[model samples]
Target: VGSRCGAAEFACRVNAAVELLDAGAPAAEAARMLADRFDCSQRQARRYVDRAAGGGRVVVAAEETVVFTVKLPAPLAIRVRERARESGGTLSALVTRALTEFLVRGQARPRLW
Candidate 1:
């Protein structure tokens, strides 16, 4: 088990572990790396990695949500907002769902042009 820590500190550690994983470190290696860096146990490091990878029991919304600013044509923005209203979803939810679908489909279909 990891040492007892506050939420913000734990989130920071998890973010660091995720960054290491994103940078191509293997799971075991990333855990070990984080353990060394944070002076935590290997088990604790693995926990952080699991949480960052979306396998944790407790979901930290603040840590998981990322804010992004996008510029869109006024007409397109209005259309998207209208669609969201029709679907009874917030603008952020609509945009997130669209982006998720687009990314998943993109992964399944390669660009030919």
Candidate 2:
């Protein structure tokens, strides 16, 4: 249980969580680590991940919903928006398609080419 704390202590905990998350700690893992470090519960750690994820800097747990803000080149961003509206698909869908293709292509092996 966390005792009554002033503003500075609160800020310190928040910063700790953000740093752990930015270092690629998963939301759940980050929460557990922070809770242990600060003598708090896992829920407190989750709050930290949520806060950082909300700031568009860290990825949230897979079970949680996160909206990512990405800035592409102007032309490409316009094209993606136009296509999404025309096709009735979401911007996420389009990006997912592109990334999936990219990963597949990168992972493909040549048959002794």
Candidate 3:
């Protein structure tokens, strides 16, 4: 994990992926290049390449952290994802900020039992 990848830089990678595809390069080739360039996992690089090749919307948000998973209500999960997309932030970031404020800053009110 590292600092967030800038929009321009991610876009450049996608653009390069597109160019590579157009140049008759194979999917694996593009993915390998991306992995080497970004020092990311092969799976993640393939994801980047596949998403770019599919002509679908792609967004990149890097955060410094370890993997932490918790189940949430479906609606809450959807809302968080939507907020991240709309705000160009990551779920990890939003959750980290919220937890820091609530637990560290002592700003959250007591919940009803």
Best by lDDT: 1
lDDT, candidate 3, 34-99, per-residue tens: 878878777777876785787534444454456788999999999989987777655766887778
lDDT of 2 by residue, 5-113 (tens): 4445555676787788789988898889888988877887688667666543332223433577877899998998899777654576677778879889877966565
Better of 1 and 2 by lDDT: 1
Q: Over the full model, what C-alpha lDDT does candidate 1 score relative to the true structure?
A: 0.79
- Per-prediction TM-score, please? 0.47, 0.45, 0.45
Order of candidates by lDDT, top first?
Answer: 1, 3, 2
User: In model 3, where do residues sit more than 4 Å from their true spots?
Assistant: 1-3, 56-113
Score residue 4 of candidate 2 by CA lDDT: 55
| Model 1 lDDT, residue 51, Cα | 70
Off by over 4 Å in 2: 56-113
Report the error of model 2 at residue 84, Å: 31
Tens-digit lDDT string for candidate 1 (1-113): 44597666776888887788788888899999988998999998898888767632232345455679999999999999999888754687689879989999999998999
lDDT: the better of candidates 1 and 3: 1
Return the lDDT, model 3, position 37: 85
Number of the candidate with higher TM-score, 1 or 3:
1
List per-prediction Cα lDDT, in the order shown: 0.79, 0.71, 0.73
Model 3, residue 89: distance off in Å is 17
